[model samples]
Target: MQCLYFDQDVTSGTLTIDDPELAGENLFDVSSQRKRYIRNHKYGMVYQNPVKGLRMDFSSISNIAEKQIAAGGRHVGNMQSAGERLLDVVSIPLFRMKEEPRNFSGGMQQRVQIAKALSNDPPILFLDEVTTGLDLSVQAAVIDLIKQIQRDLGISMIVVSHDLAVIRMLADRTLVMLNGRVIESGLTDQILEDPNHAYTQQLVYSLL
Candidate 1:
């Protein structure tokens, strides 16, 4: 919700880095080139659909390497090493580095997408419904992997998901939104167990 660039309905706000405020392009305006630079260098995004975020026909390593390549990486060996290390970081096997993501399982594809997102080593990562379509076991594994990555890298993440389980596992603070407005905001455990808002209470009960 913080990054309203992807939201068509968002109309007002300021996204800033340091002192100069970045007008919500959705509201005010921004140069395309500057937006591209901000997205490429400062923000890493993993979409719900792997195909939307990844090059399905490319090798997993190639998909990850592209980020580095865009960031001015020229050495093949270094790029390949970084790719493999990212794969390992995301719990993907090194052998799959040469394989296309189109052939991987949904869980594996998600992992590859995560690796690609981290390729630039961006300070902020935005994950939009990342575990949406995976099997329950796979969802659990992916969530665990995300938690581990956060612990090891200390990268801040903004995760958007309707799944309460994911919030419980990965979020420290929680916000419950209804009709584009936040109805409740508090510590994850407190929000889940003792929701003050009526809608939030219903959401909690439905999950139980």
Candidate 2:
């Protein structure tokens, strides 16, 4: 994911760049600088914004292959080959292989985000508000794509969405958090039909 921090603080808050736990640890502490901690930390905290989390300079294809290149997937003279292979995997348009990401539409851009996340071959994918601004049709497409990616990749998907429709469609299990605590947790259908916690009830009712 591409994360841009204009006047943003990436530490010590809900961002959880350091720990998978999503809370605790002082940002001022110098120990947070280690690459090992950064790389291996939460695989399920999608940045609050999609555009903030990506590299705008690269094409969708380039972005997808970036992880492989970082891990030395590119041999002496096969960089293009590696890229083309990844493009096929991520479903990027081969015709626009060299276009910058700013040129794509919102849905296309989101697909690039997915491609970039999958590039590292992460076992768990975090999708934070992935469909916030899209219309229903586009939202459905993106949600379906995520499910397809998860199934084909065999990875756990943590989709953080305030939209119940998205949750009901994409989530296998659901967790309801209010005031920063988990108030309810169970299968999506169960939670939708019968929420035990008041916060969950409010949240479910709000969907109506």
Candidate 3:
């Protein structure tokens, strides 16, 4: 699989792009302007902490609209409509759309973050430990929301999580990393059923 390497120590490796817009280009060697273009136009990211992904003091709708504006959206009415639509998609009540994310619960805050991330409708989304700090029930709900969004939007998602159950629920393919290296990778069911690496085997067994 063609994967984007992030925050990894790579002494020598060429990161090639498969997207037709920049096909065969080495991402590792991209110019700063090219990188900015890629970031603003091609990718959406949800951080582990809602604070990192959202402006806490901004209203949920404003937060979402700001992302749309950043992505070159100019129509005020259209941006507001998009923000409301995303909030509904994420199951946040419309009445609370004007409330700041800081006033919401962890799950609600995460939902706002997800809405904002989808504001520009990027093809690829990077979700980093999105459910890490939520309650169990909230985590399940968030996971379900992600699954539904993926089904409805068909957007590619790179979800990073330490929880095997979360992986079981969200991933089609799995990559097990150890000390920054991918130790095992395959179909999620295959890894859960018969992990090849010793550490992977132990991880699977412990969940039983």
Candidate 4:
């Protein structure tokens, strides 16, 4: 569902990248190669499971640096420095740079994945169930980190989660999906407080 908005192979509906280089180009109509390029150069995605988004066996530095390399980075020193800085920003100690994410705690692994996603400085980010399965404190800390990064970088973020608390913290707008369809859409506060659809109302009430 998140992929539909970002030019993944959806069955129908028009999608377009708003960047100057790809101005008004219909994403669904574009060639697959072009779509791949757009995804590689314009967006970042963090999956719910770190394994899906990160190389578990690679050192954290290597995982983060790989994104830069894929985006055309050539200088090893520059890439290494950038990776270390991002890891520091994500609250992972620089001493852990040589360690693989497989050895880190769940929260730490998620942080490494986040660092890797941001390695290319993409304008848009997609997060799918990022806080699921984390301890409450760890989840809160990671959410705060994400919020800070969004504010500092001013990057566009689309977060997908069933957790209302997570949505309330990170989202300005909300789309309440029932099954595969969006049954309600509005500002996050409004959707939570004054839902228009029955499904949305029930969902919100359960949370309360």
Q: Indicate which candidate wins on TM-score.
A: 4
- Candidate 4 segments exceeding 4 Å error: 5-8
lDDT of 4 by residue, 41-108 (tens): 78888889999889988999999888898788999999999999999999999998999999999999
Give the total clashing residue pairs for model 3: 0
Worst lDDT 10-window in candidate 1: 19-28
Model with the higher TM-score, candidate 3 or 4: 4
Tens-digit lDDT track of model 2 for 87-153? 6665677888788888877777777777666655666677888889887898788888877877787
Q: Ranking under TM-score, best-scoring first?
A: 4, 3, 1, 2
> Per-residue error at 37 for model 1, in Å?
1.1
Give one digit per residue, the lDDT tens place, for model 1 in 128-202.
899999999999899989999899999888889998889988888998899987888989999998989999888
Best by lDDT: 4
Estimated TM-score per prediction? 0.89, 0.75, 0.93, 0.95
Candidate 4: worst-modelled 10 consecutive residues by lDDT: 1-10
Model 2 stretches with alpha carbons more than 4 Å out: 1-48, 76-79
Each prediction's whole-model lDDT (CA): 0.83, 0.67, 0.87, 0.88
